[model samples]
Target: MINGRDPRIDFFRGLALIFIFWDHVPGNPFAQLTVRNYGFSDAAEIFVFLAGYAAVLAYGRIALRDGFVVACVRILRRAWVLYVVHIFLLTLLMGIVFVANNHVETRDMIQEMGLSYFVRNPQQALADELLLRFKPNLTDPLPLYILLLLALPLILPWMLRRTEYVVGLSVALYLMVPLFGWNLSAYEGGVWYFNPVAWQLLFVLGGACAIRGQRPSAPQPRPLKQQPLFIVCATYVVISGLITLSWKWPGLHEMLIPKAISDLLYPISKTDLSPARLLHFLALAYCAAKLLPTGQAWLNNWPAQQTCRMGRYSLEVFCLSVLLAPLADMANALAGDTWPMQVFTALLGLGLMMLMASGLELNKRLGTPGRVVAV
Candidate 1:
């Protein structure tokens, strides 16, 4: 029986955090094993979807018990916290990249990481950063998340009362993006990398799913394996796997995927959250849900539990990952991106993240004063 917190959410969120760390380190060999290589979607989808799910689980409960006003205060307060973290993270990342460049004579690090504007025009860049405009690469997701969380005050009430209508509105906004070229403006000129307009659909859907799961009186949804739609999802996952594997084996890929289909899906849009990526993540999520049902005892095993600890402290772990990325890059550049070095860098970075999570867990266990544990 599903009761209290679900371990699966933390498990997957932690796993996504790990993948995000691996993917951020450009030359890491382990990155190829991440979900992005085998599927249309990657850690970003998992992160955002789980964010939405967790938001509902956390703020939704507060709304139910304490009233909408209290929920709004809590949600908006959390958003403010995320905003502050983003600013600090951006400052720290710039510092890291700057120092790394000077030490290694890799001046292009700033430009390569998309922080050149700060170097070229500090005043304007500082202004843009304050306005949440000038986000460097690997930092885009936070602003998008901030916007979504800020909107939760309005979103959560509707989600609890008119779930379909709220989701329908989110989808309508998503469809309008492609039709009307809608997007939130970014630093200097371009649109947000993870366009919130389109991505909100996934976020809202995740929240809806969490709401459904929480209602004990409502009939539980059928298991994915029992559903006819599972066959289609599984088939899509298999085909995507084959297509991605083509990167390793070009000849086999050519034989597996026709040129016409490849051309049609080429440049699968991450900025717009393309349909292929969205559906692929949904399929992967369905399979995960089925395979790891609720309250599975094995989830409490040491490694899984440790990963869950990381998920429990996702914000801290994610901030650490962002900061560690440039350092990892510097290490890779210095040590040479040999297979051994890449593997070592990836392992070491992951170990540090685990260690940080462990420290936070330790804080909670010790009931340290002023240490707020996230739900």
Candidate 2:
């Protein structure tokens, strides 16, 4: 059976990218309301996790048809393409911003365009971005994806071939968030905005689900007649309520686990990883997967499919937004807290991204959405 693209997943991806862009836009009211804020509930985790999940669903077929070695090589090359795109866009943004801010002599502009200009300064303000010494931060998504892609060889291997290992490791990693807070210092705050070790677990979970034909985590499934949609909605509400109560009644966090595991439930100072937050995230992810998709034919209409198209090309879209984000930030700063301007910036950014991706796809370049071709 052919496992064609699922419109729901694609639409979800597009929605994530939209929120991601809005979240980065200054003064977005939805920023705090969305899941990307404090702890594991952020959009980053969901996106990255889904990325892994999607990779397995789309590329595992190629891996099965080709050889694992060939598949792994292809994945690495694809990752390198992402890295190049990131650098190319970063250079463009930096150059444009610098020129806008100052009167650059022709010679100075040429000199700034040189790769050395961006890479030479060890202590420069953007040294973290250039050297990859620290994570790209909320300033951009490049650094986060870069790390995840870099480590894919190690993680993806087991996930693709060894089903049990993948599930076990994902759980262990998720559990570790509470046992030992994620160490941003270990990665040199290089990937500060996204914690690969902790966040990878979500992707692994998504991957596992996709690999199993989009089944629930467990083998046992209740019949639709018995599994009421109301139950799923209730589960989500109860989880949200608990998360809210935990915040209001700080003491409720203690009740999240047995006394032995209680220590793992609190936030580690100066880091985003905490079991308490992970609990809420897992709950949210579960609820979303259950509630979304009712096998409706019209749900995948042309307009709805566009959202998935946005998602299918999310990395490219997000990269474009990152390049324009600073510009949006500046626009917002100058325009004051105006929602109209924010909306304008978002539309412009997303349009440019779509155009860029269209160009890339036309040329058969990276970021084109399709199944990976095995060597």
Candidate 3:
């Protein structure tokens, strides 16, 4: 952990960011290998959970040292910055898609991007965009994250005092979503792609973990075989993996997952953060934590170092990823969507993302003149 910022978190975050970029490009073959292929949860879960973990760790310190008011202001300011970036990114995306639509003969980029609304109703679209409602493709997570950060001030104090209570409250709110259809408003009379009411539980759980991490160390953990909870988590992870992989073959999926069980777990909604999805993520996280120690030698390698740099400068890297996704899709489409072209675009995009990360690190080292504080 450099400067009290865990490289493990950054490494995982960077890995998830790469997954998000791949998943954003619809029909990209590389996306078939992402986390979603192995479980009910996807990279978005990791992104939101880590966002909460990082936000609380960064701002909670200010709450202790500078006072709660200062921390609240700082959190709000960061949220506002995210909101602005979302708007600006959306604007650029629309323009890029518009130009690409004309250039790409195989696909209609604007239609694929869900930008038809903006084309038809410019005035209303602009209004909704300002109100945080007009979310096109590849733009959902930022808005979801912005709202999560906005609400941090309210529960953050309670989180510092009693993280359990905050988690309980968050759980209660999440439960109400399925019971009462609670959700935030979105563009064109639809609810948010990511329901904040349901997702807050993950965010809160992440913050709870962060707060717990700040306390003194507990006893050394038991071995994997000796830990019953770890065993259960590991089993669930394996079961979920087989089930998720079975989805690739409909006959196998049906044979492997019986109607009785399928009925029980069907319609697993990412929008509402369904219970099965949540459990799968928690189980996956538990197994990953138990199996992978933070200080492994592999984590110090060249690829890992680049990924860690991408994680350290996550916001900028994420923005570049958002912009790069559709462009990568276009590039592949231009090459007739062949396997070779698909792999090329995917690798090229990752390389560009890594390059941007290294450039940012270099700029920070040369331009900044103070102690490197964790963001």
Candidate 4:
């Protein structure tokens, strides 16, 4: 585990990054195995939640020790770095897709990935991109993260003092989104795929969890296990799992569910973070925390340690995954979409990601010796 960092968070974030890679490669067959198939929430939820949790652990501590202004400056500086990385990644992704489109007669990769607007209206799209308004398919999450980081300073102080108020305001904004049709506009006239207004609730919830020292890897009171809330959370998880499995077997689903309940939960709105999705994720998180208590030995083992390493360098790994996704798609196209090909691509892609993480870790270790020698 990274020094002073929670191993569980790193492991989950790394796992989520792997899942995100699989999900991005549509029709890879491995997509069926990711969290989305078993629940209303997907890797996106995990990614955003952990991001908030980490942000608080990192920046909130700075605010508490240093002044709020110093913490705000640091947060804004990090946001600026993410912004720069995003623009660079966007340019590189477009270039890769453009080249891939030229060679292959597959569907226009440009339009399919939502970069056609750049070609059609370069000036406007460029302006929108600079303003963080023009996000393509896989590019949406970064901008959302950057925006959340930018807004962190405004709420960090309040969150430190009156956590309930901050969370309440986040929830209020989330509820208002569906109620009032509120959303930030994208270039070419559409709303963001992961609407920040609704998604911020998870981020803030993560922050609150971190601030209260309630991470999955933290010790909890024994009474928590015996609480009525624990039973409810477990029951909800089981019910949700059954419901998700029904999607795979329609007849079984029909036999199990009443028409009224099915109708009410139909079209589980992911963009809006509907109550069903939110509650399901919360239940899953509760189960995870209960099952994997603080300082679990298994988490420090080989595979989990590698995953944690990846999580420590999430920004680099995530950007690399985004860049690698189209190439994976191209490989899928070339290698025939059989089960074997899908599995091969998934393993190969994930293995490469792990290798990259390991390389980064090695570089850090090797560089340390030189610094020590210099000192």
TM-score of each: 0.93, 0.72, 0.96, 0.92
Off by over 4 Å in 4: 1-4, 214-225, 369-375
Best by TM-score: 3
Best by lDDT: 3
lDDT ranking from best candidate downward: 3, 1, 4, 2
Tens-digit per-residue lDDT, 21-56, candidate 4? 989986877788899988888898899999999998
Which 10-residue span in candidate 2 carries the lowest summed lDDT?
Answer: 104-113
Order by TM-score, highest first: 3, 1, 4, 2
**Candidates 1 and 4, the one with greater lDDT:** 1
Better of 1 and 3 by TM-score: 3
Candidate 3 residue pairs that clash: none
| Model 3, CA-based lDDT | 0.88
Candidate 3 RMSD computed on C-alpha atoms after optimal superposition onto the true structure: 3.0
Deviation of model 4 at 140, angstroms: 1.0
Summing lDDT over every window of 10 consecutive residues in candidate 1, give the lowest-scoring window: 216-225
Off by over 4 Å in 2: 30-40, 96-131, 173-191, 214-272, 294-298, 301-303, 351-375
Give a tens-digit lDDT track for model 3, residues 1-375.
102455678988999989999998877888988999999999999988888889988888889888899999999999999988998999988888887788799878898898999999999999999998989988888998999999999998999998889998899999998899999888888999899999989999888878877676766577688889998998998999999989889999998888999999989999999999999999988788768785757697998988888988889889999899889888878888888888888899999999999999988887778857666
Off by over 4 Å in 1: 1-3, 217-226, 249-255, 368-375
Residue-level lDDT of model 2, residues 1-375, one tens digit each, is: 216555667766777777787777657655655555433355665676678777777667667678667777877887788777866776676665565334422223323232343435535635555555433334335655666666666766576667779789777876675577653442232335456556666667777767766443463377543676646544655655555446656676656645664454434321344544455556666666665654757565755655666787787777777657666666654676488887677677767766665665555744457857556
Better of 1 and 3 by lDDT: 3
